[model samples]
Target: MTSIVSVRDLKKSYAGGFEALSGVNLEIEKGEILALLGPNGAGKTTLISTICGISIPTSGTVRVGGHDVVTDFRAARNLIGLVPQEINLEPFETVMNTVRFSRGLFGKPRNDALIDQILKDLSLHDKRDSKIMMLSGGMKRRVLIAKALSHEPSILFLDEPTAGVDVELRKDMWDVVAKLKASGVTIILTTHYIEEAEAIADRVGIISKGSILLVEKKEDLMQRMGKKRLRIELSTPISELPQELADRGLEIAADGNALIHDYDTRSDRTGITALLKDLQNAGLKMTDLETQQSSLEDIFVDLVRETS
Candidate 1:
């Protein structure tokens, strides 16, 4: 599997001496979906802008499909498409003209059939004759996607594609992304929706304070950094935990109906058997017991906090 995009020691600094990115390195494989996760001001957007040649880097190198982003910008940019966070389409332009014009910008020959396929694939065929100003917010967002795909680039960058949209629209967008993946298009997306990444991304990258914290396979990251919580419903209400059980790091619920214990899944011993035995010895009766694995959002928060 060869990388379609690569970055090395990428850095960006403003005139005010603020660094947006510092020595960032990443590789996006051909035809793979990679999700970039970070808090606001964490430099996720800055990194993507540099890779797509929208913003110049202060230092470092970025290559798209073997073409250097700086030295070979035209060739590199022609192979990639970007859907920015903001919707800035021409208000008076019809949907079909907008998409067709985008293709012409890339020097692609006029092909109504290809443009029609893109419009249909994005569910914007019915709105082809509608003006951009006449469409709703979700419809406008779909137009942006159709325009981006007009050039038929190998790589696509989606920046918060589903922000502020309704649940139904978001799900529809995900379905479109699935079809794009099936067509062998590599996608790199920046999102605040952790669940979306967990549901769609093949790999996850965490960035914080202008640096990439870690990148790993979704399953591997979850298995290695994810924790398991054992929740026990208490039969008897207790104001506080007993001294004998205080060493186990158990947390009593505010409602006084449950006890929560967290244990690392990768640990050699989860101590569940010992903990259960001790609870019985202490005369604590459990009505029910259940375990929950930590979500990607939990792991992301922990990692960012640790680095910050």
Candidate 2:
């Protein structure tokens, strides 16, 4: 697959000398869903803005579909659509007209059939004639998506697409995104919800302090960084680990009724077999045992903390 959007040494600096993005490099594959995970002020939006030609880069280069964002702004931007974080729709304008105006602004030929399908896909067909101010927040959000898709962009940027929405509505938006991915639209979304990335993204990128910390396939990231903990619930409480189990580096739980062991999932030898053998040799009675896998949120928080 070819790269639909490419960034090389991308940098963005403000008047006050604050760098929003520093020496960033990335390649977005065609028809893939990439999720940008970061905390506030982590430069997620700045990166997206630069790639979409919404913000001019201080230095370095970005190309969308082989066109430089700076020198070939029109060609690069024409293939992209952005649903920004803010709700900036015309309050008094009807939904249908609003989407149609967006299409016309892009110099696209009037195609009511395309607009109709976009509205229907977003469940906004019935609300097409309603004023933006009269619709609920979720409906307004769907309108934004409809407007963005009106021009038939190949690359779509959804920044905080589900922010400030209820759980049901968020899931609804996820379904919409899934359908878009099915239609072969390359998507780059910045989301605060870890589950959102875990649930839909093909690959995940973590950024902090104007730098990209890591980018990996979602399943690969989880398998490599995802740690598992074995909790040995003992029938009898013990104050200290037996001398024979000292080499295991096990820790006693706060309640003193169980033992905890952390292990890497990627290792061929997880040491669980050895630990169990040691426990039996030490004559320790285990009432029950369970394992827990670390979530993407855990990995993200740890990465940011280390970088900070």
Give me the candidate number with maximum TM-score. Answer: 2
Give the alpha-carbon lDDT of every model. Answer: 0.92, 0.93
Tens digit per residue, CA lDDT, model 1, 252-296: 988998999999878899999999998998899999999988788
Candidate 2 residue runs with Cα over 4 Å from true position: 231-278, 285-292
For model 1, the stretches where C-alpha displacement exceeds 4 angstroms are 224-226, 231-292
TM, every model: 0.84, 0.87
Among these predictions, the greatest lDDT belongs to 2
Clashes of each: 0, 0
Candidate 1's clash total is 0
Superposed on all Cα atoms, the candidates' RMSDs to the truth, in angstroms, are 4.9, 3.9
lDDT of 2 by residue, 6-95 (tens): 999999999999999998999999999999999999999999999988889999999999999999999998999999999989999999
